[model samples]
Target: MNITPSLKKVIGLCLPLLFSISAIAQPVRPKANWQNLDLQADGMFGISTEKAYNELLKDKKPVPVIVAVLDGGVDINHEDLKNVIWVNTKEIAGNGIDDDHNGYADDVNGWNFLGSKKGNVEFDNLEITRILKKDWYKYAYADTTKLSKDELAKYHQQQKLSRELNDKLEDARKNLDLYTKVKTVYERVFKKIGKQEPTLEDFADFIPDNPMEAQVKMVTMRELPKAKNFKEFYAQSIIDPIKFCNEEINYHLNLDYDSRDIVGDDYNNSNEHYYGNPTVNGPTTTHGTHVAGIIGASRDNGIGVKGVANNVQIMSVNCVPNGDERDKDIANAIRYAVDNGAKVINMSFGRPYCTDKAVVDEAIKYAMSKDVLLVHAAGNDNEDLDKKANYPTPFYNDGGHADAWLTVGASGFRDDQTLKADFSNYGKQTVDVFAPGIKINSTVPGSAYVEYGGTSMASPVVAGLAALIRSYYPKLTAVQVKEIIIASVVKVNHNVDIERKGKIKHIAFADLCRTGGIVNAYQALKLAESRAN
Candidate 1:
């Protein structure tokens, strides 16, 4: 079986991370320092994607690479993404028996750690919500069966957990209602400023090198058609305050977090030989599908936007949920991707609380052992990771350096006006680079597409960039790619233009983030080429 397919069949591999490739139409004489190039204007955003494709092809090579997406299932049948699925030639599709004997019965595309042979993934939360309310009806709050004194005490203990969860839910519901009210008021005020959309249309494509436009881009206003003050409207119009509040509530406050009670198995071990099915996609694969499209969606597919890399293979490793992901599943997914021949792993999700570190931490060590680069999201929380805590970090260098893991944060759409998004996490201690993450148009399930924002979107942009470097340079170690991304990021505007309190603040962008820059493929190519020498 020729597991190494032709590079032409691969989609994202064509993007050359090195300048010497066919894509580098006019290269400068080689130099020692890594070169940098601006990509926002020269990028493939506004112009026809085909024209961008040709320019890239002139100095690029299409190579196939595998990126493991440890998130909700990926939409395999997406219109712009159908051609890039990583098919398993080692085993026949839909075979009841494990033909390849790799433990999974028939992983045609990749394994789904979250599902079974029936292919369902709408599982519950991390903490079970069932115990609450039901037991509230009980008088003695005991199972009322033949129970010893010790057993009776245990029953009450579990019942207490139920009460705590219901209280948490009540608080969350109240918070949501409050946020919705604030957002509705702002929506009306923002409309008086601009008649068309809720967002500041005046902010679009206005690349301001000056400070005044940047001013109009940072102010927040109350619920009134106040004077057309760009600064006041920019703050409220650009951010979805309710969405941010809800995401925070969902992760931290949900007391009945364990929604996975239906699986009927222990999550602490890997003893189960076969747990999932070949029909890997689930009901809600929007997040993974969006990330995948950003990395390797087929170009010139006559439907949607082009992916970052040109020729690459996408493998589904469904593990994370809408809620918190377990350490065991994450650890297993990384090992699985490495053992199955993935050169790059894109983990666009992160959690603050990980009590069990053995399975996933060992998996990180295993990925390093197998020479795979792991790209992870730096989280969406606006706190600085240096002072704050974030997991799945790449920094093992005690003396001030990075490891094999690269953490990326979200960069806003308008690079000039308060370029740093209000929701993106930043840190000189951990975060390596920033990328376009605001309202990105990407693939969704069933031949559809939608715009989403998060470090989830940023991680795969770097992952695709990693694929480009691996395909072109081939000799660069996974650790080296991590360094290149960090060192080669383009320093964008130093504008502090985000919402805080009831108004927008104008601060330097560099002050908000560690790198104070965004990822540029053009510059990364030059850096990769110069460093190779």
Candidate 2:
């Protein structure tokens, strides 16, 4: 599977210590596959999902649980995922009418909130960008003479956003031009050297006569030594810069464009529903398909990696886009999943700003009321969630938080220096637990697989564990399951080093999250069995 440049930016920015395919060639020990393994007599951190299935759930009549993948979209036809995909018996497939009369016409599997009657929206600006574009004057250049406290606060926010957007755009444009020029020079020098892979010695031996030739030689001389071959050099100098430039040019800085128009929904009206297409796998299925496979890809299929849960059905809910997911769409997606019998909802997308957080908050409460569990990614930005807000959070306006919601931070396989994922956001109060997210191998759009990492990957691991717990126990409430998972965490009793503000600081692992430990499925099942007895 080809990872697009923009996706790398989106996924990479979210995660600070991402392992690129080109970067890490050697595989770590098999035990480092923490997401799959169970804890042995030796102290290792893992969910122990497969171990539980083998020892406990093998002979048991496991109940099937519905887990929702609410993200970009999912490829319902992926080889390992085909049989596990949820099918709606009440609604007929390809029938022009609403068979179930649920406002959606022919939604046999799931709904696509990111698409419309016209087509699907692939890319969009962030909500902060939209705020800057629409309300620039209110905060861009305000007079301090006669302003209320609320007005002054808003003005400051607008000014900050404007500065960030402009600065990023300028940096991207400059780097794009620099990379383009460097690539042109590097190619010409390689051709002159008459080698497919040029070396520094080759450049030093050849002398240039003209100004253009001299410039080419200068750039190649400095760059060739860093790369072992021409392919690596071209990718770094040409591919990465072009990808960055294209994203800035086409979406982020493109203020005049609005992808929401394609959806044909009243963006201002949070109450308005029933507007999207039935095509769940809109434009790109890479992100969402990978997420779903982690939750419950068919076990013993002999094709792809087995998911956490063995007896589960995946409901694809398309609300996230290549860019930011709107608050309205997210709220509706949650409500739809809950109403359609999704017991566990996994949201792997979020942004720094939200247009209408109240609606989303209300939807979360509604899910809680229905006994549905929401597992969210703690975001890739390595910041404190207690200080900075990641939208679609369980924190409500009523000054209370949702009981059935779990905010997960990313963890690595090792329990030493690289224990926590460098890019994962941590919070002593806001975030609940940690899970394996580094170099996760999962299913992509085609009948292929790839290694991707982020808190996005971490969230689904917990969601899959939730499904596994509910499937085996069958009597645990959403809140009870959340507590069991948190209570059963394998606590890290020592201090760990973490990078913050460009400096490594030794802090207690307990300070990183409310639960100072990682989620353990074997422990959780043991607790559940005790509680049941």
Candidate 3:
């Protein structure tokens, strides 16, 4: 699949009725830069990016900060991102030699761990599927009597995950069928109406000539008011959801599907680090491009959306695939970013399981030794992470947490019940703070801009604020920066609506995260300046 739909899109498939109703009653679109707006000055729950730049950073000379975006892939050549894209100054481009002698040859930009000389791995199996596939033959037909205690536990887990995967795959197949039928109906309606892109007025005035026409008309009339045109509705409602289902069936849940050969690395070798190609922008760059733009997309550029941090270089370290990223790859990516002088690393991907967490834990410790801060996204599962585990966590096997790590949840633009993003994963002990992630406008592939919602979007917001702080205060340590950001959060002291166990519940906003508030760039800068003085 050339297009890799995100996990949020899959969740949307499960709640189509709720989303459809919301679409029918959708409000006017917020400003493109609403995520950067100040809460006090603009009445939007943003990071106060503009106010900080205009006031605190107007006269101060900023030191350039390198922030590594460890995601799927980034379009380094994006018009708004080109100037801010990090360049390996010592290495020459297209020389077919390891110019910097860092094991990666001709790495002028950054490296793509997901690609080899053949091509990039656009999609791969999820962690659960990989776990099931690894021990399938041994336990698929083994007798329970022959298994030892540890082996029996492993076998039971395998069986449970197997059943879950089968059930999910079946649901995906059914959703695919349903979306395909709806798409066909939409096409028939459009063909009958003789319009490639119908307006709301066109849909409102549309009269049914047949049973199928009437059915589609009813659907479109309920849905078309929010969409600007039929093409937008068709793509969002039909095309993207169908693609998400296909991704689930063909790659994530398919044990027979393997793309590791494309990388040509020894699957058993955890020590192998210098194997991937230099193609940083893989087949799909939508997710990574949007993430990079969120952190540092050339603030002075007249076109496209403004990024969070200024005077920062975004290093593209492509490691994540469409599905769950591997532990070995994540560990290597963190080490690579830290070795290459990345002061802060943004990891916007996570899964529920960790096959080998020791490697990742060691990598995070390595980052801490180098005084590098790591910011991660609380996953979009909308669960409490204090009870459930998320991979690449700050808490190591030994007991101590990584002081340089920050876990972020998604916050929205409103101060009402919707302040916390409905899809954000939360935990008072696990998540550090919330940031603007709902309907955030950022750069995508081909110089385009769009709004996307996820904890993936929220992680970069905190990472950007960290970069902004580092840019102004060069003397602050990574731990100090992390502390300042958390200590200076804009506190929220009211109840907010959150969905738990498939039920809407009103909970204190303070209970959602450790900071009990949203990230504020302006406040963080003030605290950093005070500490510097």
Candidate 4:
């Protein structure tokens, strides 16, 4: 059972195909079911949780609940989110010192594992970066007495890739900055020309060719306030991927190995604890803030959308950085949440694969040991996960998961089973359930609210439902709670067809996910009552 650091590297490279699953789109579904189901009236929260909540209210079990959100940082100051922030009793509020011994001090709200420094975010490991650093040599070359040609080929591939990534990262940074600048300029000009929202039809006679390439067009189009013109301006500002590729090749890829660069800890000693204080929280919370609001922003405050869990405390864990989350930080975050008392967890992030399998596995195992129900997003890549292995999977690195883990995918406005979102990851065997994901409005940083997309939005929907179940049916174990969620969804439009393998393929709702249907909170409570009877 002793795995060296080198062995972990080999498995990561060879297992590129490990979690490669297809995300097929579903066919047309009936809209009547959606209309007949009063998403508002059905739930206690007066909002659709995909399942009605009012029915769950019959049992009359409501308590202050807690859900951990693992994502980019959350905006603690958001108008909708400022009220329900999880307070750490062990640590003092807003103090510079770590009085509590919870490892992360001053985490009064949450942690921001990914700090706001743009350059600080590391790039994902691509084939190219492995070459320039020759870091791949240690993993691919176990013995130097006899080297394989394949090894040499890999080195060459890495070299070529390193150059490309360096170029990519730099270009990406510049383009991001440039686009914002150009957008500002364009907005300024568009407003001066057209005080009100204008239409693209207004410019039918005037066309800007190679619009995206034309900086002039970007400036003019952005100022127009019309829906069509706004779309046109958006299209014009799109930067070419070429710029980002070259920069990534130069900076992060060509850089040397420095594991100590991020958190300033000795990564060599995984058992060495007491390196951090408990007073950590997020700084740039655009993504996490929105997700928190979806799970438990104060409802009916006459501001934003209703959260699924009414009386739940949201312990914002700042584990995910702007890039992929470090296994060590995530592991620690899991333990922190569990040690502090979190029953339901929501993870809205995933990497292409797990770099540190042991670290991730142990953390997930630890969470289960506490009987926590962990829910995760199926990813936004639109690939099938049945075969493809994404990082932080419900199952351990070995592909066998302990119960209490649920993998959720995105469902759209369409009611048919065939209509899996064009952006959602699907697997008849791997994914556990589905929820609404399109155009979700949630809280953001600076007390603002904006609509966002991706299965990232879909995850909180289920986590909230899981909380509601636990709130009403406290007798149910984590495993039973997962089962009730999967077994009770209404299979109204079971048979549907959607895109798969570049062609339309027919499938049943049960075939799309392990659960076979979207979550129905209303049915869940009814089932819980029956079990009690």
Candidate 5:
């Protein structure tokens, strides 16, 4: 089947909606249980977690398995998640000392890498920005004739980074101005309407005499219909973008910003282990808590959405910040999780580049040596990861890739030509499998729940299944668990339309990933049970 130019434009616009939290909040399909429904039976293309728990593991007693949530932070006090959080038995809580002598003090639940003895690190520059700024003097007035191969390469990288950062900073400034303008108009027009919730018809009926009012009326009438109500429209269009611009301007693109000063650790020292505090759930725990809820939110508790693994304990390991996670923190977080007995580790964050790829590679190798499974998000860039690199990838810095690592792409609820998530990054070699990521309902911070969409959400679904498998089949090695997941995928036997080169192209879904299918909890468990020792 060939895609028309018009259809391609539609697909391109539609795909990005999967990544926008506000866009997917009110889906087209009402009463959508698509993420939880069985694909083979219901045509929803989910992991069939409920079916597996109800039928396959009905009578079996599951051994408790610890899965690590390595992200910004996890809300340990979440109403639905408090019970399933991992507790360190050997280490005493709030003693002001390292009772277990594990180099961390008062780590009752988990350690926070974004925090230090002084305070929390709120924002950080990208790894590339940091590297470019560090070597600015060396490359600023470089003699190309006298430069070595490595030095020239570094110079070129710095040039590329300088351009990218300048472009992003300029774009962010424009967006902030545009959003601020639109917000002022929205507020003025809304006041004139004299209603809490104004509809498109209300805007149409509103007569704007002034030029400023006319601009607001035009923009609001055009874009307001996409939202469910006034609050959502204001939040999504005005508030969120403004906040994002502020972060970009003040934090991400700020080359002079040093979060390590607050962290008070030598970030270059990969061996500096004990520098963080016991604040597992930092200022914002929404992302990490949501990932944790997807992996091991208590099943049969009747409080919130059920996690994929019922008998699993979530170990929170904080490292990520609002912008980019440092490689040193990521390596230490992975090592900590592995040393503390996490069989499966879920990393839902990634950057376009890394400054300390070698350190991260060593940590991955350490996890692999410990027979631990690492599951990572394929990223929401909608690009081919095999062609373009995503940092902290399956590929190692030294030589080979991590064998036990599973990179996952996001799968939508639909089982049609557009089954693959519009925002998912696909690669035949890079991404191993797919899972539910569109409009995923999970736990948020403040003991609340919300729907979020990203490869970040998709990763923990696979990790939860890994935990479920290891819980029942305790003797199966991490390598065996990885194989079972990739082997037992429910193949999508159809040609799907995916965004490529800014246009929609019809390609076989099987070709999008190595597994060519979505992750199936039921099938994975069946495969694991067959091989269980």
Candidate 6:
């Protein structure tokens, strides 16, 4: 039930904003593992992983690199992921004491900052809701004439966000009712027609006896063709959206709801870090499991999807939640990963707002000092990040940015005008590069595979590539790896359509990102080898 930052803006307006049901029904690529294919040989804008592995890395032995997945949670027991899951060799499993004496006890895999002995924090409020909850009493009835400029601006911003949140809640409730009624209509019609799973032909053959049945029949006929069967369409279109709406009403936008009590941490203290339990796979593991599979799912398992990197250990650091992640948890997660020997940390979650950016900034610096590369999702909002800021950015408050950080945008499976994912956020200065994110087939919970689209999926592609390079070229610094990846991108020399504000604008694909190209695993590896030599 996790939502990307970009999807948060339009989630209530329509169905789940990440991937449309129609888009899911008809994928851009026929195969799930098209992201690893070559653009020239396969006609898809992939990272050329197969080419790289066959041509260059055929006989080369790779040193296992630790890549930390900082997300909601991960299914460590997943068959495709279990082999590659990082095990803390120094720590004893199921022991209450911190055997390694690193403040975390029984952290055999990684740490969960959103949990304690009580339970894991499943759902939390958004950053905006938290902000309003803390400051509404201070500014709600204040005299505008006496307020300072910054204070007045903050007040107005809060007011606008409050209105937007309320509107989205109302929209969610309406959408929930509409979808519930539609589901009921479909169920009644299906029962009356005596079909357990109806097809388009089945719907066409049956005659509706009532107005509700007639309406259901029309919708089923129109949508059933887009899906494999009636049950799938119902689950994806109706059940999933209903769950999202319920999550929004109960947690994300609910001011009274607080999951921090479960954590039992000093919420006011930004530096208090050693309080979370060792439950890395929290309540939900779908989002984190998918991200882990993209980075380093077991490649030689002969089942499920092959990950981008072969010789990598994925350390699951559960910090993100169904809603916005807290800055403290994020900062602690970064530090934990760095301290635990993670060479590359993949952060596939983000938000548009930050309550304490300085703490996270300090943690970023800490990771940089420890020679850790951080790959982040630019966002899914389809907006220019230069104008609108995203949290956990490389840029610091004092001025300079982190050299080891790479912000990635989502690229589609084509090589033409639609190369850039329509929902991917881009910036000539902010976004470092693009990666194969659209219709990405990756591992989910219970040994299954699914397709997801977003910059969230894109970031792990680059992270896996980074891990690949670091594994082969162990001497390359994090900053050097960042430079090599950016310098060796597959340059797009054509125009692409990007929606700005409300209108679509045709712009040079190069203008969207710093490199004006997509991340190329083969090219990046070639560059790393040359530099290593």
Cα TM-score per model: 0.70, 0.85, 0.94, 0.74, 0.89, 0.91
Tens digits of per-residue lDDT for model 1 on 40-150? 443322112233234544576656888877777788888888898888788888657778888877788888777664445553343333333224355244555776787
lDDT: worst 10-residue window of model 4: 10-19
Candidate 6 clashing pairs, residues 3+ apart or interchain: none
Q: Where is model 4 more than 4 Å wrong at Cα?
A: 1-47, 58-61, 94-100, 112-145, 148-262, 276-281, 416-418, 492-509
Measured with C-alpha atoms, the lDDT of residue 248 in candidate 2 is: 69
Q: How many residue pairs clash in each candidate?
A: 34, 3, 0, 66, 0, 0
lDDT of 5 by residue, 1-533 (tens): 12111111111111223123223323354124356579767767788888887889999999999999998788998998999999999888877989888888888888898887688877788676787789989998999889999999988988998998888788778767866876777677778889756888898999997998886677666556544455655654566667777777887788888777888888778878888899999865778898999898887888888898988889999898877788999999999999988999999888778878888898999999999999998887778988988789878756788999999998877777667777678899788999988667788888887666678888999999999999999999999999999999999899877765655688999888899999998988999989884
C-alpha local distance difference test of each model: 0.60, 0.78, 0.84, 0.59, 0.80, 0.84
Model 1 stretches with alpha carbons more than 4 Å out: 1-57, 126-171, 175-261, 270-274, 395-402, 498-507, 512-514
Q: Listing every candidate in turn, what is its Cα RMSD in Å to the true structure after a full C-alpha superposition?
A: 12.4, 5.7, 3.2, 8.6, 4.8, 3.5
User: lDDT (0-100) at residue 185 of candidate 5?
Assistant: 74
Residue-level lDDT for 141 in candidate 2 = 66
Score candidate 2 by TM-score against the native: 0.85
Worst 10 residues of 2 by lDDT: 14-23
Output candidate 4 Cα RMSD.
8.6
lDDT of 4 by residue, 219-293 (tens): 333333321234432432222222232333443334553323545566555554444433234433567777788
Best by TM-score: 3
